[model samples]
Target: MNIAIVGLGVIGGSFAKGLQAAGYTNVYGIDVSESTLKIAVDQGMIKKGFIEANDILQDMDVIMISLYPNQIAPFVEQHKNRLKDGAVLTDVTGVKTTIIEKVSNILPSTVDFVFAHPMRGSEKQGIIGADHKRFIGANALITPIATNKEASLQLIEKLYKEIGFDQVTRVSPEKHDEQIAYVSQLMHVLSVAVVNSQQASEETLTYAGNSFQELTRIADINAELWSELFLNNRTGLLKSIEHFEIELDALKHTLEENDDERLKAIFRQATNKRREWY
Candidate 1:
């Protein structure tokens, strides 16, 4: 299928790489940065694609908008008419409810846009870090609007399956964001908090423990992009952070009292909860 991916950063670039790895040809891309486009072409993720949106919509089979949350609404509004009738549209944005609602408001009846979120990402940004293998077995969430055809939806599912993500499932856009708040967004927030709280000198930081080091792994995130996500889904994210803080505060009180039995019980509960993944 001929695919046109907008916002050629991590998720967009990875989609191109995965499409190629799955033996799909005629993959196209659109991004504002010339340098990133060059990196994508040089890496052979795209065969040939134009940076101009209007110039490249003629033969676009399926469109994937992997942009930051705020862009989803206006971007789709502008391009809804340009996309060919019956062409399926989808996205890889982190939060889906607002985006899906924005899409629903502006989308023409002719073109169908489905909302999907692949549960895979990395700290790195841009085409430089694009890897097809990253989401090989990861969960890919598909949430189609009421207007979308069953066959068209299946086509998107088939494409993901071909790229080795058959563990696909359905989700309502609202629930997708609520679940992701704890699983993905809150993790970034915690990492940022850890990095912000630390005031160690460079030499002093060199002796950090394993857990301390791990806590800050995602702290130095790309602020510009992450800022967009955090604000767009601010409500859900704030609730997740608040609940996490409450849990942490309870543990702090346990430690202050040297409550051995309570600490052991808390650790045991965490272990039991974590063991389910094993």
Candidate 2:
């Protein structure tokens, strides 16, 4: 199991450490950030480290791309041909259709790219955030493109299970991206918008309520990384935001009209939905 992780950030580091803890060896960390590589090596998260993409794939049996969405196309283009024959290359990237489609279009048939998304993360970053505890019982969605489903879906699911993921669900790229656009991408947008709308002064934060505090916690996100995701999945995210706006407007209408009956009905609906939700 010669595994190569390109980002060496939170997800990559977590997966590397998880594999190691599962008794696997020969894991390699690859990242452009020299500091990140040093941190992983010092922590023994990966057996060794490499700075270049080429160096990392030389002996890699499986490669996981943990870079941002915008970086996926170019990264795949450069490494598609270099992959060892019969090697399985998957990614921890959130969006699937865009990445899987472009990569499959460019890569050779010998290379199997099993697209997957682990719906787990923390507000932290870098190798320090490498422990795979968050993934112990998290659901991992293994998204395989139509052309690649029969080719590598089973292998990807097996790997996720071996990594201690709680459950493995499969879906097409189109469906995966559509759902993520709401659950993952939309939440980030809402968090950003909520925090920005406040534009709170230092004093205001000092007086913030628990509810306000909890809602805006994710606002302390990596702007560069999140901004890329919002833009990459702009079409889907915009649609999610639009749906949210419509609902919010309806609530505002109820409040402005002081329609007690309508408000109660709305609250009842929300309560029922929340209670019924999984």
Candidate 3:
């Protein structure tokens, strides 16, 4: 398969490496940075690299857009004509409702765009931090729109399975955004808030336990990338935050009223719900 991965950042670079490792020989890396392209080629992540959209992309069987949410539409619009007919286009972007709606309107019917989200990442940035290990046996979500082609969805699911995703669950864009707001976006928000709430110094970190470290691991985030994602799905994110606030207020109320039984009940319920995941 001739696969083209746009934006050679961490996720894109990881996709290149993962696909190559899975025996896909004709992987191509595309990025705006010439140096990044050269690095990708030298690292053997991709068989070829391009700094700009060209005739080479017309031959691509699949094109995966790994750009930030805000940049995805412009990238597709700029290179729409260069995309091959009957080619399957997919994305690893987190936010989907707006992206799926806008891209569907702009892209030609000759090509198929399958919107997908790979629910795996690190707090690191750039191709230098790319690792295919992060995706091994990870869960992938295929958020399909009404206009999406059945064949395109099948191709993307197969591609994710081949790249080592253990679970591939399909959902509508609405449900995807609603659920991700809690599982992904809201967690990032909580991490950032928790890290910033305290005034930490060297002395404070010296006493940090594994619980603190685990909670704050994702606190070291990429602001530029996350800002775009948060804004794109602001409504759902805000709703998730509201729900969290309600639960937090309830806990605070229990503590203020000295309701020991209520607090224990809440903790027990939370523990039971979490155990369902395992």
Candidate 4:
């Protein structure tokens, strides 16, 4: 398949590498950065790279947009007509509702835009940090709108599997946002808060442990990207934050009251609940 990936950042760059590794030649990349384009070409991640949308997209079988949620709509709107007929387009943004709706509403009947979220990435930023290994055990969620045809969606599912994702599941845009709010967005908030809550002294730094490092690993995240994601899924993300706050308040009250049994019970429940993922 002739593929064009718009936005050659970490996710986009990684996707180009993954597609190339899967034996998909003719993979072209689009990015605003000239350096990124050159690097992508040099790394054999793409056959050609363009600084902007152009005629090369006219023959593309699939156009995978790996951009920020805010950029997804405008980019699709600007290039909708440039896409070839029967092209299967997809995205890898963290949040999906607004982007999917906006793009779906504007897309032509000749082309289909399928929304997907690959649950994989790193806290590191830019093309230099792109790593296809990130998707090794990740889940790829396909959030299809009514406009997406069965054949196109099925082809996308096959592509996800071909790209080495462990699982491929279909979900509505709404459900995808709600679930991601809890599983992904909330965790980033917790990590950021945990890192900020610390008041380290020179001596106290020596007492840091594995748990602290693990929990704060994602604290050094891309603030601009995360801020857009948080606002895009505001309602679901707010609800998740409220739920977390309530749990935290309960724990704080229990600790203040010196309720050892309650704390122990809470720990037991958390341990048991977490084991469910295994």
How high is the CA lDDT of each candidate model?
Answer: 0.84, 0.83, 0.90, 0.89
Q: lDDT by residue for model 2 over 1-278, one digit each (tens)? A: 78888898888999988878877788898899899999888887889888988976867888888888878778878877688888888888788777776777787787778888898977898778777878888899987665574646777677677888989998877788788999888887787777777566777778889988888888889878887777767788888889989989989999999999998998999999999985
User: lDDT tens digits, residues 1-278, model 3?
Assistant: 79999999999999999999989999999888988899999999998888876857799999999999888888888889988889999999898999887887789888888889999987889999899889889999998776678988999998888889999999989999999999999999988998888587768688999999988899999999899889989999999999999999999999899999999999999999999988
Model 1 lDDT tens row, 208-269:
88888888888869888788878878899999999999989989999999999998999999
- Please give the lDDT score at residue 61 for candidate 3: 93
For TM-score, the strongest prediction is 3
Model 2 steric clash total: 0
Q: Judging by lDDT against the true structure, name the best candidate.
A: 3
Model 1: weakest 10-residue lDDT segment is 196-205
Better of 1 and 3 by TM-score: 3
Which residue segments of model 2 deviate by more than 4 Å?
A: 149-151
Q: State the lDDT at 125 in candidate 3.
A: 90
- Checking candidate 4 for backbone clashes, the offending pairs are none
> Global lDDT for candidate 4?
0.89
Query: lDDT value for candidate 3?
Result: 0.90
Name the candidate, 2 or 3, with the larger lDDT value: 3
